[model samples]
Each structure stands twice: as structure tokens, then as C-alpha cells.
Target: GAGVSQTPSNKVTEKGKYVELRCDPISGHTALYWYRQSLGQGPEFLIYFQGTGAADDSGLPNDRFFAVRPEGSVSTLKIQRTERGDSAVYLCASSPGLGLSGANVLTFGAGSRLTVL
Candidate 1:
């Protein structure tokens, strides 16, 4: 992919349904990240993958949220038993490396909008 790409762009679902969002990252990038952005806040990091392994997953709010990068190129985020509080834009980003001091710039996808009712 030239840049990160996410599917559906917008999804509307009833509360308690399961949904899967996909992300395709830039080619050759070694790092991928998932984030959730609420209405008025910045993107909060949910998980980070360096290659095929999850290097950090501390931002996932609960057991209902999970993500995977099976082959290190594309990833999916699955939400189980979704809540109204889960309505937000899910963002995906990729970088060459996890630079020190948070200096690395992530090229972000437009994002998948998940709306729970």
C-alpha cells in the first residue's frame, strides 16, 4: 500500500454486536499502531506491533478489544460486546521505527468510524 488504508470508513452497529476493522499499512514499514479517538480528544494508542509481535498493548481499554497483525503487513481490530461508549474513530498508523523521544512521525489512515447504538 502507498499509505495506510482502512475498510468501510464508517460503520453503524447496534450495541452488543461484534465488529472487525481492518488496516493495511504502508509497504515496508516495520511498525504498526492502532488508536482510538473520541469526539474531542487526540488519538489514544491502543496497541503497537513491531513486525509480527505485539510490542505494546497497554492501551486497550478492556477484554472486548483485541488486535492482531498476523503476517506483519495488515492488521485487524475486533470489538466484542460493543458498547455505546465504543463509538469513535479507530485510527491506524505506521512508521519506520519507534523512534526515541516520540519523535517518529506516523503516517495515519483516514480511519474507521464505528458508531454503536
Candidate 2:
């Protein structure tokens, strides 16, 4: 099966600009998640989708960040009014959708590195 993947492995943008990052999850995986990792820090949960619905989105920092998983497969993270603080690595992961019953081991994509100027 194809593993999760992300594009633009690196992104450089000016402050206040908008950017959209994409993620493609593994085949047959129904649970997807997004997380942000700053330098020297662990990945922070951003949003997660179980099927077509977002099961948890509490980690979204602010209105500047948003995500969507329309078909319960591929997903995208959109950022608006980019700021230097927004610079970080955006990672996407997916699991077997069994929630607590499953191993919950998330297979992460390489991640998209965002740098705000």
C-alpha cells in the first residue's frame, strides 16, 4: 500500500501571505491527522479526520489555519496571513481507523517545512 505523502517538502513565504499544503494518506487507512512541529519540540496535534468528518480540531492554533478531508482520503492544510511564528514542519499521519482498539501507530509523511519571511 502507498504510504502518506506531502508536497513542497519546503515552503518559503512572506508574512501575511497564504499557503496551502497537501497530504495523501495511505490506502485503506481511514484515520488521518495533522500536526505541527517546531524546532526541538514534539509534534503538536492540529486536526484529525475520521472519514469525511473532522473528529478533532482542537489543536488548530487560530483562524489562520484550516484543513479539509472531503473524500476521507487526501487532505489539505490552508494557512492565511502567514507569520514568522507560523514557521514549522507540518506533518500528516494516518492509521487503521480503529481508534483505541488499533495499534494507533501513525505513519507520518516526510512533512512540509514552512518558513515565514
Candidate 3:
């Protein structure tokens, strides 16, 4: 896809269930990011992958939240023991490798909205 793509645009689940959200990035993009946006808040960074490895994941709130980019092009965010507070829009973004001169703008997907019941 020309832009990032996220699956399961809407998910409704019970608390304590496990959920996996998938993100397919634009081909050839080397940097991918996962973020969560709650009501009345901006997207909060969850993780960033440079190639297949996680370059930064300090944004993850707890051990239950995990993200992986195993092959560099595709990434997934996994939430274990979901809670009502976990409900939010999971956003995926990607960009060409960062340049030395300045910051890079990321291309974002529509995001997957999760609602915990």
C-alpha cells in the first residue's frame, strides 16, 4: 500500500482478553512506529522500530503491551490482559530512514479503534 494500513479497524472485546493489532507499513520504509490515542489526547508513542529491531520502546506503559517488527515491513501490537482503560485508537506510522539534517515526517494509517467491554 502507498500508505500505512491497519487491520480490524474496530474491535470490541471483554476485559482480560488478549488482542493483537496488525500494521502493514509502506514498502521500503525503514522506520515504523506504534502509538495509542485515548479520548481527548494526542497519540502517545508506544514503540519505534528501525528495520526489524526495536530501536526505542520506552513509551510502552507496561510489560503487557508489546510490539514487534519481525521482518521490518510488518509490525504488530499485542495487548495482554486488556482492561477498560486500554481502549483507544492504535495508530501506525512509518517513514523513510531518518536523515542527518532534520526530522522525518511519518505517514499514518487510519488506526484501529479498540473498545473494551
Candidate 4:
């Protein structure tokens, strides 16, 4: 896809289960980010990957959340021991690196809705 693409638009899982959400960013984009949005709340950054390495991951709530961009293009967000409170819409975004003016605009996907029962 020309834009960011996320798979399994919706997912329903039982508590204590694990889930993996996949994202494919636009070709040539070197910056990718993962975020989660709960009901009535804005999306919160989970991690940001520059190329094949994570540039920032301080937003991850805890060890239960993790993300990887192995090839610097496709990325995966992994959630372990899912809880009811963990249910939310996971969002993926990508940018073509910072502009000369230091502006970095992102293009976001439709998001992957996760529901824990």
C-alpha cells in the first residue's frame, strides 16, 4: 500500500491471551510509530522506530507491550497477558523523516481495534 497498512482491523481476545498487530509502512519512510487509544482518550505513543532500531520507547506502559521493526519497513506490536483494560485501538504511523525545516508529519493507518473479554 502507498500508505501505512494495519492488519486484522478488529480482534477479540480473552483476558490473559496474547495478541500481535502488524503494520506495513509506506516505502522509503524511515520513521515509524506505534500508539494506543482507549475510549474517550487520545492516542498515546508506545514506541518510535527509526530505521531498524527503536529511537524511543518511554511511552510503553510496561513490559507487557513491545514493538519491533526488523527490516525498517514492516513492524509488529506485541502485547502479552492481555487484560480488559488493555483493550483499545492500536494505531500505526509513518513519516518520511524530518524535513529541512525540522517538521515531521505522519500518516496514520485506520487502526486495529482490540477487545479483551
Candidate 5:
């Protein structure tokens, strides 16, 4: 992919259902991040992966939320037992992960809009 790409631009589900959001990052980018944006707030970090391994996942609210980057290029965010409170736009971003510039330069996807009813 030339840029970060997220699937299911809009997803609406009832509470207690399971949901999965996918992200396809730019080719060769080794750093990927998952974020959540509520109705009126900036994006909040949920996880960061330096490669196939997750370097940080502290921002996840609980056990119900999980993400994985198998080949280091594509990622998936899984949410179990979804709740209305979980409604938000899930953002995916990727960077080069080469040096200091890697930490600052990010290409963001349009984001997956999750709406729990």
C-alpha cells in the first residue's frame, strides 16, 4: 500500500457483539500504531508495534481490545463484547521506524468508524 489503509469505513453493531478492524500500512514501514478518537477529542494511542512484535499496548482499556500485526505490514484490531462506550473512530498510522524522524513522521489512514448501538 502507498499509504495507511483501514477497512470498513463505517461499522455499526449492537452491544455485546464482536468487531474487527483491519489496517494495511504503507510498504516498508516498520512502525505501526493504533489509536482511538472519540466524538470531540484528539486521537488516543491504543497500541504501538515496532515490527511483528508489540512494543507498547498499555493504552488498551481492557482485555476485550486486542490487536496484531502478523507480517508487520498489516494489522487487525479485535474487540470482544463491544459496548456503547466503545463507539469511536479507530485510527491506524505507520512510519518508517528508521530513526528520530521515524518517530515524528506518520501517515494516517481515514480510520474505521465504530458505532455500538
Candidate 6:
């Protein structure tokens, strides 16, 4: 796809298991983000990366969740000790830049559905 891309569109895991979600953004995009959406709720921001560094990660629920953009392009989200409450759609987005001017503008990919049993 020309826009953002997410792998393993659907995932089912047992409680306490670990899972990883991947995202690939547009070629020239410099900003990437991860979001989580549970049933009947709005998407919640999880993390944001600019270039190869995490620009904002305060949204992450706890130390169990982490994300990385090793080369400033593709990113991966890792979840540890998965719980049923953690089940949600993981979304990936990218933009040309960050900050006030382009913060609201983003190209989002189809989310990854996760179910923890």
C-alpha cells in the first residue's frame, strides 16, 4: 500500500503470552504513531516516534508495552503478559512531520485486531 501498513491483521493470544505488531509507514514520512482501540471506545494514543527516536510515549499504559522504530521507517509494538483487558485494535499512522502544524494530519493503516483469552 502507498500509505501506512500493519502486519498480522488479526491475532489471538492466551493470557500471559507475548505478541508483537508491526507497522510500515510511507517512504518519506518522518512521524509514526501507535494507537489502541477497545470495543465501544475511541482510539487511545500509545506512542509516537519521530525519525529513529520515540518523540512521545507517555500514552503507553505501562512498562509492559513498548515500541521501536529502528531505522526511522518500520516500527514494531511489543506486548508482554497479555491480558484480556489488553485486547484491542492496534492502529498505526504516519505523517510527514510533527508538532502543531501537522499533528492533526495523519495517514492511518487498517488496524490489527488482538484478542487475549
> Tens digits of per-residue lDDT for model 2 on 14-51?
99999999999999899999999999999999999999
**lDDT (CA) per prediction:** 0.94, 0.94, 0.93, 0.93, 0.94, 0.94
Q: Tens digits of per-residue lDDT for model 6 on 1-117?
A: 598899999999999999999999988899999999998999899999999999889999999999999999999999999989899999999998987884548899999999999
Tens digit of lDDT per residue, candidate 4, span 1-117?
Answer: 788999989999999999999999989989999999999999999999999999999999999999999998999999999999999999999998845545678999999999999
What is candidate 6's CA lDDT for residue 5?
Answer: 91
For candidate 5, the lDDT comes to 0.94
In terms of lDDT, model 2 sits at 0.94
Show the colliding residue pairs in model 2: none
Tell me how far the alpha carbon of residue 37 in candidate 5 is from the true structure, in angstroms, after superposition.
0.2
For candidate 2, which ten residues in a row score worst on lDDT?
A: 96-105
CA error at residue 81 for candidate 2, angstroms: 0.7
Model 4 reaches what TM-score against the true structure? Answer: 0.94
Q: Candidate 6's C-alpha lDDT?
A: 0.94
- TM-score winner between candidates 4 and 6: 6
Write model 5 residue lDDT over 3-117, tens digit each, in one string: 8899999999999999999999999989999999999999999999999999999999999999999988899999999999999999999988945753659889999999999
Looking at candidate 5, what is the lDDT of residue 17?
100
Candidate 6: list runs displaced more than 4 Å: 102-104
